[model samples]
Target: MRKDWCEARKNDPTPTQMYYAKNGVITPEMEYVAKVEMLKPEYIRQLVAEGKLIIPANINHINQIPMAIGRAVKCKINANIGSSALASDINEEIEKLKVCLKYGADTVMDLSTGGDLDEIRRAIIANSTVPIGTVPIYQIIHDIKDLDNLTPQIMLECIEKQAKQGVSYFTIHAGFLLKFMPLVAKRKMGIVSRGGSLMASWMMKHHKENPFYEAFDEICDICAKYDASLSLGDSLRPGCLHDASDEAQMSELAVLGELTKRAWEKNVQVMVEGPGHVPFNQIEFNMKEEQRLCHDAPFYILGPLPTDIGAGYDHITSAIGGTMAAFHGASMLCYVTPKEHLGLPNAKDVRDGIISHKIAAHAADVALGRVGAIERDHAMSDARYKFDWNKQFELALDPDKARELHDESLPQDVFKEAEFCSMCGPKFCAYKISQEIAKIECNDYPKEKK
Candidate 1:
């Protein structure tokens, strides 16, 4: 279906959504997003034209379903699943992708640094129904083992190669400037971002500016050709609580802001990536500052884990910060797994990560009162009150897990209509008692004389 749509727009020099929106032409993608967001197509076009929202529907990614990411829409979630140099492979990554989609991940980034890079990415993109993103530098770095052999031309080629292969977006670490090195040197956890560290290494070794920044225009041209979006990577994002909202992070953000305008000038879509870790109190500031600095180009953020102590449960920590981040202004939340800072995640880790972020995103949407957001919560409440076990399970974010927990004690079909769960038996069930009290007639109670 999307191939047919792309075929019709092949004559346009820049077929990007931004181009269409700016020209007062509403594409089918805009209408699709409008229906999903419950807003008018004109409103979606207006937001895209102003660079506030992005619909990452790459022309080459014909199988992809269009999704809108912006402060005005329901907060989205991204699951990072890929093979490492030491563990995982294409099949495992694909399985992880299935889990991601099954659990409601809004986007998926193929961060595979191992196996056959081209084959792995091709397989992932071919199979993905959601927008697929990649950090082009990973494959470039892996293909060229020696940093000395890397060139700006090589970087552009990698980006173009991936874009041609139907990658919906690229996380370009172009905003990390050489001037920020001095500030990074004073940080507690200096340069936690993988892309940031790689850029910093190249800059320090060459004693020159970041190559991504230098060739950003050419990269934008590639994106415009394929209607791919640029997620300007926050290479200087804080990696720890002490480094949260520091000078280095803010400086890189300013560069991202400028890059956003440059990308927009070329009629390319853009979204700005944000922090790695941030304190609870600082999440709001980080979110708002990104909107202010990046001109509302759909801020996408990582866990921004509120604390540094959660080793095995960074997903939970990230959820805590993610809720606050999305509630404030973040358009998308990147899931963090239990193996974060420990090891590469497995399929189960991906599931846990996706569910955690989904909870966070939905909680934020409910808090913000987005259209129909609270309806699910009300339905869940009604189900619980009526002892509708099946309804409650159906309403749960993870229905299988919810049913698993409930069936741990009473796995029989008879318990499906029970008024109480494992936590409270029928004798002590409040809902059951309330039902009994409501059944009594008003005449049964003694009344005082007026």
Candidate 2:
């Protein structure tokens, strides 16, 4: 359906939604996002034109259902799934995609570093209904093998190929410059990002500036052709609490701001990726800095985990940070699963990660007072007060899990309507006693005035 929409505008120089938005045309993509976000179509278009939001609807991604990410919309979550050098297959990645969709991931990034990268991405794009993203450098380095021999042309070629394959966004690590190499010496983790580390090693070996930074204009041209948005990768993002909000991270962020403008100049949509680990106290400063530095282009961040010790439960830690990040103005939260410092995430890990970030995003929405954000919370409160178990389960983020835990105790249809669970029992139920109190009908209570 979107293919037809782009077909009609085949003669246009740029196929980007931002292009159409800047021209005062509200494309069908904007209307679709408006319906989903409960905002006016014109408002969506205005945000897109102003570079405050991004609708990553690549023209070639015909199967994609457009979604908006920005401060004006509800905070979004992204789940990363792909094959690494050791494990996972096409079928496994597909299963992960299904889990992401089922549990409310706003987007999915195919970070497959091994196996058939092209085939895996093609399968992911063909099967995905949400915007698909990738780091082209991963595939480029995987194919090239020898970092010293890698060329700018090869990098652009890989990115363009992925763009044509319906990748809705590319995480280009343009901010990691050659000058920042010395700064890593002062850090504990050094360069933690795979993309960042690769770029650093290549630059050191070749003694050249970041190819992505130098070739950014060409990359923008490619993105403009396919309407794929640019997710400026944060190569210098703090990897640990000790490194949080340091010089390396801040330096790269400044460059991200410059790249954001450069991409926007060609009418390419842009969102800047942020830090990997940030203390809770610094999340607000980091978010606000992105707004000021990037000129309000959407900010997407991974865990930004506040503490460093929650190794196994980093998902929970990140969710705690994610809430602060979103509340402070982050547009999207990339989930970190329990397997995060341990290993690759399985389908169950994916589900757990998505639910945690989903809750974080929703809580941020409620805290920010986005329209109707708290209505569901209010509904859940009412359900609990009335002892409506089924309704409570229905409103839960993970209904099956909620129902499963409830059944572990009750496990009977008779308890479906029972006024109390095993926790309180009918005799000790506060809800039951509260209802009885309402019926006391005290004569001293004030009566309605006539």
Candidate 3:
């Protein structure tokens, strides 16, 4: 069934069906995703028309399954896993991928910076069932002998290579123009994104235009050919609350607005990647600006980590910001693990990051009134009210952990037939007292009335 859907997307009999989205037609991919999401086909089309939902299905990636991102559907979560130059291990990275999948990550990005980049990417692409994304600039930087040797052509070639390798989306830092460099140079963190910093350094050394900016249309053509979606990266996103929504970030955003229109003109799907570290108050403004300026392209964000502190607990900080961001209009969240600032995350960190973002996504979905979001919560509430421990555990996000925590303080043997557990103990249990009071009132109400 999946094969037929993918083949039809590539070779549908319709004459002008270049990309499924360009023809103003609904393809099998759309139908499949709509069914999975429990949304109507026309609603998916409407969101795609407004540039709110993005379905990243590359023609070459026959194994690629379709997923939607927009206001009308459940918010999606993405897990980023890859080896760095300082530390590289293929097995460990694969383990992280397993953890991401196990914890329900909607998508994964192969940000591998070391250990035969091509091999690592191929392995990840082969292993991933969900849509995969890549930052092409990372490979271009890793390949160059010296930073000065990098050129626009090298960067463009990297993008093409990855697209052919079946990357569903590409994070092109085309907004980091040479003109925006001076502004970043004057900032506290300079450039926070690795790709953004590399481009900035290269532009400064050569005094030339940003290759991606200068060749934006050509890049769009490549994306259209493969039906690969473009994730317009925020090269000037604020790295701290102090730098939130400044002129530099807004200037790059303006450029992205122009770029987004150009991509749509070529009939290519596009999304905008947002901030690094924004405060709680500014997340909504950032979301609104992306929607207004970029013509409502799906807004994918990285933590936007409300504050700079909480190194070991950045997951919580990110979840707080992520919920607000999604509620305000962001569609996809890039999970930020505990080791965000310190180092690469292990398997446990991946699970923690995905779970945190999953919670944020569910909360936002409920607020948005997406189907089934509230139903599960209501079911869990009913189970709790009935004192049904088994049902409660079954409905929990982390059932194993929930079961373990319940067993820790309340031994099953000691409280075999009791209606309450420890923490309040039997004497002080509120629910038990309430149950007793309800029975007494029921028995005395008739006699008192007589």
The sequence of per-residue lDDT tens digits that candidate 3 reaches over residues 111-198 is 9988788888877777777888999888887888577877667777888898888888999889988877668767887778887887
Say which candidate scores most in TM-score.
1
User: Which should have the higher TM-score, number 2 or number 3?
Assistant: 2
Those runs of model 2 whose alpha carbons end farther than 4 Å from true positions after fitting are 444-450
lDDT of 2 by residue, 322-425 (tens): 99999999999999999998999999999999999999999999999998899999999999999899999999999989999999999999998999999989
Model 3 residue 434 CA deviation (Å) reads 4.1
In candidate 1, stretches whose alpha carbon ends up further than 4 angstroms from where it belongs are none
Q: Tell how far residue 254 is off in model 3, in angstroms.
A: 1.2
Candidate 2, residue 390: Cα displacement in angstroms equals: 1.8
Candidate 3: which pairs clash? Answer: none
lDDT per residue (tens digit) for residues 264-286 in model 1: 99999999999888889988898
- Candidate ranking under TM-score, highest first, comes to 1, 2, 3
Please list the residue runs of candidate 3 whose C-alpha ends up more than 4 Å from where it truly belongs after superposition. Answer: 11-18, 410-418, 432-443, 446-450
Candidate 1 colliding pairs: none
lDDT of 1: 0.92
Best by lDDT: 2
Give the candidate order by descending lDDT.
Answer: 2, 1, 3
TM-score of each: 0.98, 0.97, 0.92
